[model samples]
Target: MKVSLITATYNSEATIEDCMLSVLNQTYPNIEYIIVDGGSNEKTLKYLNEAAEKHSNIILSSEPDQGIYDALNKGIAKATGEIVGFVHSDDFLADPSIISAIVEAFKAQEVDGVYGDLHYVALENTAKIIRNWVSEPFDHRLLRRGWMPAHPTLYVKRDLYKKYGVFDLNYRIAADYDFILRIFKQPNLKFHYLPKTIVKMRVGGASNKSLKNIIQKSKEDYRAIKTNHIGNWLTILLKNVSKLKQFKS
Candidate 1:
C-alpha cells in the first residue's frame, strides 16, 4: 500500500534536509512525500525544492498558512494514499527502513492505524537523545486519563479523515491530541502498535519548548478532554501530568 507522508514546514532549513534525506532513502518505495510550507523567509524553501527535484515522488507547496494544523489539513486534502502520515519538517524517521516496517505491520495486521515510539534530541546535538517516549497499545480507558501516542509517529488511513474530518482549527497547539482522542478513543477503529522508534524529533518545538507553551498546552488539553467527554476535569489534569514521566524513561 502507498503511504502519503506530509510535512508542515516554516523556516526549518536546519533540520529539513535531514528529514528529506530520511524519507528519500527509505526502503519502501511507494511513498508520496508531500510538503506544505508556511511561506518561509529562510532557505527552507530552497532545500525543499532541492529535495523535491531529486525525488520524483516528492510533491511540495509553499504558501501562507494559519498554523501547523492548517498546513496539516492542507496536506491531508492533497493526500492520495490509502494510509496518511505526517513527519514534521523538524523531524525525521529513526531509520531508512521505518516505512518498510510500517508497511509490513499494516499488511500483516490489517490495521486502520499504526503508531510507534519517539525520541526527542537536543538541538545542539542530534545524536544526543534527550528524552524517550515509548508508546503502548491503545487502551480506551487511557483517554480519560489523558494518554496519547506520539503524534509524529502516528499514521492514519486517509478514509478515516474523510469520515471523521481534519484537525480542529480551534486548537492552536493541542489539535493533534484532540485528533488522536477522536480517532483512537472512539468506537470501532482497529489500531496497531509498532514497538519501535518511528520518528526522531528535535526539542524546542512550538508546543513543548517553553514553560509558557507548556501551560497553554495543558489548558488546551483540558479543553480537549472536556469537549470529547473523556472524564472528570481534575482527573484528566492529573492524567496529562502523568505523561511527563514518559520522557524520564
Candidate 2:
C-alpha cells in the first residue's frame, strides 16, 4: 500500500532534513512525501529546493499558513496514498523498515489504522531519550480516561480523514487530541498496535514548551473532552495523571 507522509514545516532548517531523509530512505517504495512549508525564509526553503531536485515525488509548497494544523490540512488535500501519516519537521522515523512494518500490520490484521510507540528525545541531543510514550491496543473505553496513542505514530486511511474531517483549526495546541477523540469514538474503525517505537521526536514541542502553554493545553483538552462528550473534568484529571506512569517508565 502507498503511504503518504505529510510534513508541516516552518523555519525548520535545523531539523527538517532528518525528517525528510527519514521518509525518503524508507524501505517502502511507494511513498508520496508532501511538504507544506509555512513560508520559511530560512534555510528550510533551500533544503527543500535541493531535495526536490533529487526526489521526483516531493510535492512542496512554501507559503504563509494560519498554523501547523492549517498547513497539515493543505498536505492532506494533496495526499494521494491510501494511508496518511505525519512525520513533523522535528521528528524522524525510528528506522527504514518502520513504514514497511506498518503496511504489513495493516494487511495482516485488517485494521483501519496502525500506530506504535513514540520516543521524545532531548532537542539538544537527539540520541538521548527523554521520555517514552508506550501505547497499547485500541480500546474505546480508554478514550474516556483520556488515553490516546502518540499522534506521530498514527497512520490512518485517507478516506477516514475525509469522512471524519481534519483537525479543527480552532484548537491551537490540542487539535491532535481532539482529532484522535473524534476518530476513536467511532465504532466502525479499528486499529493495530505495532508494539514498537515508530517515531522519535525532539523535545520542546509547541504544546508543552512552557507553563502558559501547558495551562492552555489543559483548558483546550478539557474543552475537547467536554465537546466530544467523552467525559467531564475528571477525564482531564485522569489524562494528566496517566502521564505519570509514562514518565516513570
Candidate 3:
C-alpha cells in the first residue's frame, strides 16, 4: 500500500534534516513525503528544499499556519496515500524498515490502524534513549483506564481520516489526545499493535516542555475525556499515572 507520511516544520532547522534523512532512508519505497512548513523564519526551509531536491517525491508547501496541528491538517488534506502517518521535525523513524514493518502488519491483519512503541531519545543524541513508551493492542474499554498508543507511532487508513475529520484546532497542546479519543471511541475501528519501536522522538515536546504546558495538557486531556463521554477526571488521572512506567522502559 502507498503510505503518505507528513511532517510539520516550523523553526526546526536544528533537527529537520535528521528527521528528513530518517524518512528518506526508509526501506519502504512507496512512501510519498509531504512537508508543511509554518513559514519558518530560520534555516528550516533550506534543509527541506535540499531534501526535496534529492527526493522528487517530496511535495513541499511553506505558509503561515495556526500551529503544528494546523500544518498537519494541511498536509493531511493534500495526502493521497492509502495510509497516513506523521514524522514530526523533532522525530525520526526508529529504523529504515519501520515503515515496511508497519505495512506488512497492516496487510497481515487487515486492520484500520497500526501502531507500535516509541522511544523518547535525548535531544542532542537520539541514540541515547531517555524513555520508552511501549503500547498494547487497543481496547475500547482501555480508554477508561487512560490507555492510548503513542501518537507518533500510529498510522491510520486514509479513509478513516476522511470519516473522522482532521485535528481539532480548538486544542492547543492536546489535539493529538483529542483526535485519538475521537477515533478510538468508535465501536468499529480496529487496531493492531506491533511490539516494536517505530519512531524515535526527541524529548521536550511542547506538551511536556514546561510546567505551564503540562498543566494545560492536563486540563485539555480531562476536557477530552469529558467531551468524548468516555471517562471522568479519574480517567485523566490514570492516563497521567501510566506515564510513570514509561521511564523504566
Candidate 4:
C-alpha cells in the first residue's frame, strides 16, 4: 500500500534535514511524502527545495498557515495514498525499515490502523533518551482510563479521516487527543499495536513547553473527554498521572 507521510514545519532549518532524510531513506518504495511548511525561513526552504529536487515522490507547500493543526489538515486533504501518517519536523522514524514494518502489520492483521511505541530524546542530543512511551493493544475500555497511542506513532487508513473528520482547530494543544477519542471510540474500527518503537521525537513540544501551556492543555483535554463522552473529570487526572511512567520507562 502507498503510505502518505506528512511533516509540518516552520523555521525548522536545524532539524528539517534529518526529518526529510528519514523519509527519503525509507526502505518502503511506495511512500508519497508531503511537507506542509508554514512559511519557513529561506534556509529551511533551501533544504526542502533541494530534497524535493532529488526525490520525485515529495510534494511540498510553503505558505502561511493558522497553526500546526491547520497545516496537518491541509496535508490530509492532499493525501491520495492508501494510508496516512505524520513525521513532525522535530521527529524522525526510528529506522529506515519502520514504514515497511508498519505496512506489514497492516496487511497481516487487516486492521484499520497501526500504532507503536515512541521515544522522546533530548533536543540537543537525539541519542540521549528522555522518555519512552510504550503503548498497549487497543481495548475500547482503555479510553475511559485516559489511554491513547502516541500520536506520532499512529498510521491510519486515509478513509478514516474522511469518515470521522480532520483535526478540530478549536483545540490548540489537545486536538490529537480529541481526534483519537473520536475515531477510536467507534466500535467497528480495528487498530493493531505493533510492539516496537516507530518514532523518536525530540523533547520540548508545544504542549509541554511551559506551565501555561500545560494548564491550557489540561483544560482542552478535559473538554475533549467530555465532548467525546468517554469519561469524567477524573479521566484528565488519570491522563496526567499516566505520563509519570514514561519517565520511569
TM-score of each: 0.96, 0.98, 0.98, 0.99
Model 1 residue 107 CA deviation in Å: 1.4
Q: Which sections of candidate 4 miss by over 4 Å? A: none
Candidate 3 residues 130-190, lDDT tens each? Answer: 9999998888889999888999999999998799889989999989988899999998888
Scored by Cα lDDT, where does model 4 land?
0.95
Best by lDDT: 4
Reference-based lDDT, residue 245, model 1: 77
Task: Please provide, for model 2 over 1-249, each residue's C-alpha lDDT reduced to its tens digit, 9 standing for 90 to 100.
Answer: 889999999999999988999999998999999999999988999999899889998999999999999999999999999999999999999999999999999999998899999999989888888888999988999988889899999999999889999999999999999999998899999998999999999989998899999999999999999878898888889988887776633
Q: Give the lowest summed-lDDT range of ten residues in model 4.
A: 240-249
**For model 2, what is the error of residue 235's alpha carbon versus the real structure, in angstroms, after optimal superposition?**
0.9
lDDT score, candidate 2, position 219: 98
**Candidates 1 and 2, the one with greater TM-score:** 2
Of the two candidates 1 and 2, the one with more favorable lDDT, higher being better, is 2
lDDT of each: 0.88, 0.93, 0.93, 0.95
| Higher-ranked by lDDT: 1 or 4 | 4
Worst 10 residues of 3 by lDDT: 240-249
Deviation in Å, model 4, residue 92 alpha carbon: 0.6
